[model samples]
Target: MSSHSTGTGKHHPVPKRYALLFACCLLLAIALLADFLWASSSNLSSSSHSSLNLSLDSSNEVVAVSVSTPPQPRSIKKKKEPKAVNRELMYLNATYADIPAPHWDWEEMPEAPVPRLDGFAIQLQNLFYVFAGYGSIDHVHSHVDIFNFTSNTWVGRFDMPKEMANSHLGMATDGRYIYAISGQYGPQCRKPTNRNFVLDTKTKQWSELPSLPVPRYAPATQLWRGRLHVMGGSKEDRHEPGLEHWSLAVKNGKALEAEWRVEVPISRGGPHRACIVANDKLLVIGGQEGDFMAKPGSPIFKCSRRHEVVYTDVYMLDDGNQWKQLPPMPKPNSHIESAWVIVNNSIIIVGGTTEKHPITKKMILVGEVFRFNLDNLEWSVIGRMPFRMKTTLVGFWDGWLYFTSGQRDRGPSDPSPKRVVGSTWRTKLHL
Candidate 1:
């Protein structure tokens, strides 16, 4: 396939949207892959807002909620007759707070012999294997890091399958192996490729899998009723991103090939996103979706040519196709960050940056948090991010959340961005 260029490559110093994707993780797997057990806060300061306790029901159904008020932004207009966000929904409030800070991790990764970013991670039996993010767009990644929590350090270094390329994509783990799916090919291709392969944890072997319907970044995958649902991502023909839905069914360890079919119809989501699956539905939180075109039956990448602005809308799709509109976000964003985490049945959206306004002169960091309630289609604003997008990586464990990295605020790609008090922090979530 011939590669395409997105725009004039005009260096837009300011990002259009802020509140981006966080860890779109499942509760069972989060504890397995990321060793977020250690609560570190050597540089921790008290959060500005006092923790408020709201009793939650044990049935696992989401309680309708919304941030309701944003500290009276003496400037931003207050929402009119703010309706109390509903709770019975599944993706209502996609925001909640419970992450411990560990910005120091960003510092630790490089000081060692390895340098990687936008990598993919999977876990099995307290062991996590992260592979494939490169040091930068100008370079290529050729190594993998295996971290053992039981030992509290890097266990070993291994070579990834030569076919492995690109970070900023999707990976899913079955607790036995990891499937590295759709993402770009370094700086070579403008759109992501559907090339996918499986990583065997024991032998550390990579095996190829069937390709996806579309080639794009940030699409999420999940094991639902014995099938692999690959949904969400950004696609471009010549302009903007794409919003489309497709599914991959794998049964008894076999992926159905030549199966790039868009069966169920839907409104295009951002061509890229940090999606998670629950109860036969795919929940798409923050990320970017552009070119609001209506392509009821057209293929995803085929609809890529048209370009437009990005967005931050939380949508839902049951059966992996039909998309339903839900509550709008308090802010406007066409997210470019990775800030997604899944708890029980809820989706947590963490930090990223958004343009200060339409003029795009200044960039403001998004420290806010949002969660989605799938059942009632509501949104809840949790709180502010303790740090920046590039330097933050959040993982949830034992009802608590943890984060690592620098106080990475959004800024133009500079030779040396003002890296801040690198440290770790953790928070206790009131479920």
Candidate 2:
């Protein structure tokens, strides 16, 4: 029995080292198989999709695992939106007619002296009536020089009553009666008169009426709906405050008797402003404000002043007396004496003084023509006049725009102290 026990011990269950080696070899083979399968699945997933992933479970067994890659971001392009267009406003035609030839033709006043500067000219019954302006001696004339197109002569002269002898006033006619409103009494007078008067075309006599509520110099006068509308003149001086609009209350039967009615106050007031009645609307154009003094290079003997404020704004007065501001003028005029006429249903603003030199600060005379279209409310340059004109008295009749008694051809180096034009120029109307 001892010998059997010893032999069994010596052969110790097929050697422990060998049994341990066999177990390790089996584990290594299983690991190798698992690695081979994992690598194959990884390659297959990569070929089928964008990416592949692998993970181990709790039991440590070879398992076929799959994970989906998140979707890749995409690039997109955006579209731009369009802008809105204005639908209410209309535009005028870009083209304008050219100025005619022989722009200025001298009309023989034939009288002892020609009509002076800052005078007003109006036509009624084929006769041109010029009145109430300062003469060569700087004396305000209450005289009226009448030019008849029928006889082609200065036929008659009428003197305003002594009470109504005033210059720098507004004049308007209602076919039968010529109305004269507020103005300066004399050439050198700084005080403005509120006195109003009317002249009978048949009798050629002056009669006094109710005075203006706001006495002003160079106020605008117009006849609309048988009512005289007076507007926008200086109260104290050229830029004096308290300027306003007033209308003469016309009695249905009475011709001369009318009461002064207050209308609207002008926010910006100046002398020689342009007023025109068009399309039943009252349009007040460019105006001037500032003191007048001698120019830089004016002659020692002569005297003139530089314009300070040249207005570029335009306004229209409605029935309710509200001023509707319009688009400003492209080329502004310095002098309030901008001449205006209505032709072919459009308002034409003629020559006026320029503000000053950009460097030299001298005023200039320009003959630019601008047309305001009533239908479209747009402005266009209708070419320039043949000659420079400023502070001119203008009138429209018989299809012609007449420019008379204005300053022209003034330059910086040779500035004239008494720069006034006495010649009358006519241009045909072309829309």
Candidate 3:
């Protein structure tokens, strides 16, 4: 009673809500302490794993670790194309420094003894035997003009046999004898003759040989191993060209035996063949083909420049007696009657003709020059002539290429004034 009166009596019991709150607070403090201890253990474990990775890498081991990073986009690559080339510029710069162009020193040879066109020329020793061709507008010549390079003059002029006045004849020489085969004769040139003539150049004598099986104008004739091989020409007219190959046996290496037979029929046969024999191969170059010539009943006798397809097609006689085609000539040189010669085993082609206009069939003379090398099988334009020329006969002697007389602008039709030249142009071919 005394203690209660002097101080406050003993406290009463707590409320139920307050007692529940105190119990919850005590449980939360215990949970927080446990979480801190768990965090420390996880940190120590992570440091130990990183140390293990470093030790493995130093010991020359491979350790792959996967990371959860967002995937990155991949990059693509592209290809580049080649650039275009200029062909014309390439051609102009085709000249080589090592193989400098041929030192072309041209000189005018003595004027030919006679002016003619569509004739054939052969070189024997130092003499040139120019056979008969069209001498005048109305007639063909039978006169043989001999050009003596030794004497530097036309030493002699002889007449062919009265029956042998022919033009557009196929001629070949065997060093001593000249074999004159079929040709177009008479004033009208309508008469295609099969008369074969032989001339002993040494004896200055002429004799008849076995006639050709069929008469043709400008037959592709050449002497192969002493046998006369005649290929293609027009049978009736220049328009009707055939593909018959005829050969005759040479008796005593001079006279032609009577036997005449067809060797082979090849479609490569054409007119105005600039034929040459090199490396045991007979090469036939530009000529005329197809039925573009004046018709049989037409007013003209010879083929005119109308709808004619010039033969740029080349043919070579193989060892097996077959004709095989070679690479074609360049364009704009489709007309035949080009001057050609084999210089240093290279076929050098000179002036020719081409169509003057697309609509008009008339032809214009060209002075383009090109070289074909069999070694490389390539064609290149080497040089050009000083003046336009067509139907000019070409021959090679020593180091000079001789271009004999030919017509300038004259064609089959006599509409233009005749301009035949007798000049002999000599070009020094650089080997």
Candidate 4:
């Protein structure tokens, strides 16, 4: 019927057409795949692995995959360790449980008496300088007692023109001058110190400056970002406590005088307001809002742990000027004394008071040294203090932790227990 069609072939040209169509389709698919592979290869080179997958139906054995990629396996390159700004603290070297040079020896006094009464310590020229705090809790001290490390002796420094003591006065150093601001003579002081002054350790002179916007005592003053942060102390209000956080400009040779402005509401902010300029942030620790805020006029409340009446908590300031609460002190101490030093980026709390009553309890010591890591917000017990003592003032100097004599009401029920310790001890630990 046709031109003698080939064996088993009906319209052979149709098969030829189909073969040609299949070839072109296959060619088109190959071109598209090439483009896809080119684009994907660069992407894959940057990734951990490289591969391509496709399925095929070869019933007729005419259509089949023809990929030409040579298989290649992947390997990972090692990563580089990044650089750090501050010195690294390796915990394994957790060295230094500084006991007194002689544990059994309690000297009537140390060799060089630390020239300090109630004065706050300021670090200048790598040594601590004591400015006007009460020579005794009962006396007002107007003299500046400077402790020289190079000489390892005490020198009566020039006086702060506007000398302050016993007042909730705060001291802060800008690596050059020590600023002594607002405090009163007594804890019951009803009036705020309008007196604010700066002691230029460089020139050995005291200069008076503009006073605080409002008078407050027990304020936490610290130097942060080249500015001074003076935050939350008690300002007398009728029923509620006055609460606010402020930051100030403390630069020299300025057109105008130094001034402060409200930054945040301390009540709802980070770190309940035991702020220190540690790890480059305003670290606010354990705070409350009651008579503990005792506006010098109001009765000052003493320490009470179970009182749970006050907010016993801690918080840290983040980069965005935000607050993050930390795991609170296992047992909160109303005061920062011999215990609770921020060293090696860990809070070292040792030899604090756990007892509320002086007459009955007889110095219940919180001797455990709790080291807190700011990074993980974890607490660990390092060691115990040589003795469980409170009223202890702690300072860090040249790889040593030195604290002035700490004395508590030793004997219970003695209206005036004559147990005042006048000794200085340095820790053997080099943090």
Candidate 5:
């Protein structure tokens, strides 16, 4: 058995080179397996990093879209706040809050048939009548024009009595009869006439009345307490202010008294004043102390420029012989004899001549619409006219305020008197 074991061991130990080759082949196989495993791990890590980067990019895009979407709604909220403040300013007085806010816009109406200034307008029923006034240059018109409210047109015109005074006339109406009192008979500062007459509007016939002992220019005439009362005007010289007050009894377009009876004199004497009887109290407001006069020997009757005292003094007559001073106007105003109307228990005075320019010393026209509250006795400026003017004829009918036939200014900036216009304007009043 010993001899067989030694021979088998000796036969197997024949080739050392084959053994070395087998060992090298095993090492190579192990190295190749380890490299394959390492490659697989690296690839997996790279794939995970790429997926994480794509997810982060998607999140960033979502965040950008959310941050850019809100400014449109914020801009729409800032545009709705100014209209509420304007409505409150329209009614200046808190006491007038109960009254509806006046919403009005001026509209043009049919022009008057004749353009005149310093004329008197009377409204009776549906008809509006315009009497004599100063025309172009030095011409005075005695023409009477009638406007029909129903037709919205000037329906008829007629000639005044030859004896009737032309310019600076004192006029009053008792619904059916219009009484024309003393005034400057002819144009260009002539002596005033003592003639007095009454016209029956229905008959269109004029009847002569007892003449005034003293002729006056632009007197304050009104029917009060069954009598035609006249007060405060310029004298026949057309420069002196008269304080004489007279009255005459009348009934049904006929004079009950043959002559006017003298009464209490006015506190102030002036021409181109507004005379109104409200609540049985006669009031005289706004006038000038002096007037334009003709040059002494000019054949054409050239008006001489003179210093005038424009005043805002207001007087009230409660009894037949007593006078009391009331609140003066907000500003000095004149030439407003027919530029006023009574509405809602308030007297509204429109365009007139105001104080001269402080610097230029030129005559200034008023553009503001003034209100005198009869109940409160306070004055406030309500509105502004489209153009400054003087001697405008004002009327109120069916909640509409009408003004026509005034001397307008040259332009908005220029307050100087330029031209006379017959253009009628109307605005609906809420109060």
Candidate 6:
């Protein structure tokens, strides 16, 4: 049936079921949107709370919030420090303005009985004893010549032991006794002997000591702490350098030990170097590595020249196993094993062989007197000698510096060769 009148335009009424369904759908949509908005707000609040930990009081008041930070990486670097300088070393500049220039009065004293090289001189009281050395015409002097300082004359002479090594002997003295160690037994460029002997200066008698395990040529020998210490020299071949060090205990001219005890090896080794005990320190200075050797199958002992390395390296041993390096010498010098004397706190080094001449390629003898100051560990050229020489025997007595018996250079300026002389000279030290 039609519910509208034809002429009047009246609208038709909605269905009750349809109206109820539309109202219910609108309410449901609103509730769903509200729930979605509440869920989004809760998620944002939870994310903000996770970063900070909040402490609340009992009244629900916020007190403090602790925020955490990411950790930083650590560095692994260190700062460097400077090295400390040793003031006692030799390279330091020394002041010597107050010191006077050495005049070297240059007086001629009584000459020795024989001209020799590579010999040993020991002063006991007022007497200066010249021991065995390489003598004239390829011969080795096996006798001891005593010089009386008071009389200024050669007082007496005595024959050494027949078995005693002549040249390149390592000698040391303890006031009354003179200890003679290993060296070349016969003469020129010969094999070294291990035979050792001790001479009583008071009784003038030679006593045999236990032989050294290894022989050395011109080794540095000294008496330290009741023991005889020997270091650095040539080996059996006479060309190779020996770095071995040995020591022996002794009391009253008698060996306390039957055999020599091995000690610390030297940093460098060769023959004709100077070894001295000063201020409780053992110092080795100015030596050469290689030396002249005898030619094989040469009946007359002809020496063959080899490349030699001369150095000025200075080493010191101050009561330890290690050897500390000190300042080197002013120049390269060798053949001065016995060409030194201790004057006060200074060591005076006399004539010796320096480096060969560059142009001439010949040996150059050292003429300047070198003074090694033990206090500051410095080296100074004190004065010049009348003549250049090597293997000189130096003695200091009564304020006089005496030198005798060495190989003198030929000609004043020429670096040709050397001649052995028994001439003696002295000068009054003004230092």
Top candidate by lDDT: 6
lDDT of 5 by residue, 1-431 (tens): 56566644566564889999999999999999999999778766655543212222544552322222222343476556667544333322221111222334788889998888878888897788988887875788998998876667889998899989987888888889999999887777777888998999999999999998888989988888889989889987788899999999988899999989999999989899998888988899999887888789988777787777888899998888798999988778899998988899999998788766544556778877888999989987777677778888888888888888979988865777889888888787654
Candidate 2 lDDT score relative to the true structure: 0.65
Of the pair 3 and 4, which is ahead by TM-score? 3
Residue 379 alpha-carbon offset, candidate 1, angstroms: 3.1
- Which candidate, 3 or 6, has the higher TM-score? 6
| All candidates: TM-score | 0.59, 0.66, 0.68, 0.60, 0.75, 0.75
What is the per-residue lDDT of model 3 for residues 273-296, given as tens digits with 9 covering 90 to 100? 666677878777767664334436
Give a tens-digit lDDT track for model 2, residues 224-336: 77678887766655445346677775432224445667888766767666877788887778777764433345343133554466677788876846888988776566444
Q: 407, model 4: CA deviation in Å?
A: 4.2
Please provide, for model 4 over 160-202, each residue's C-alpha lDDT reduced to its tens digit, 9 standing for 90 to 100.
5644544446667777787776766443223456467777777
Residue 173 C-alpha lDDT in model 6:
87
Q: What is the Å distance of residue 396 in model 4 from its true position?
A: 2.0
Residue 146, model 5, lDDT = 88
Q: What lDDT would each prediction earn against the true structure?
A: 0.52, 0.65, 0.67, 0.51, 0.82, 0.83
lDDT for model 6, on a 0 to 1 scale? 0.83
**Which RMSD values do the candidates have, in order?**
29.7, 22.7, 22.3, 24.3, 21.4, 24.4
**Candidate 6 structure quality by residue, lDDT tens digits, 134-218:** 7764788999998887778988999999999888888888899999999987876778899899999888999999998888888
Candidate 5 RMSD to the real structure:
21.4
Question: Which pairs of residues have clashing backbones in candidate 2?
Answer: 293-305, 406-421
Cand. 1 Cα-lDDT:
0.52
Q: Candidate 4 local accuracy as lDDT?
A: 0.51
* Model 5 CA lDDT for position 268: 89
TM-score of 5: 0.75
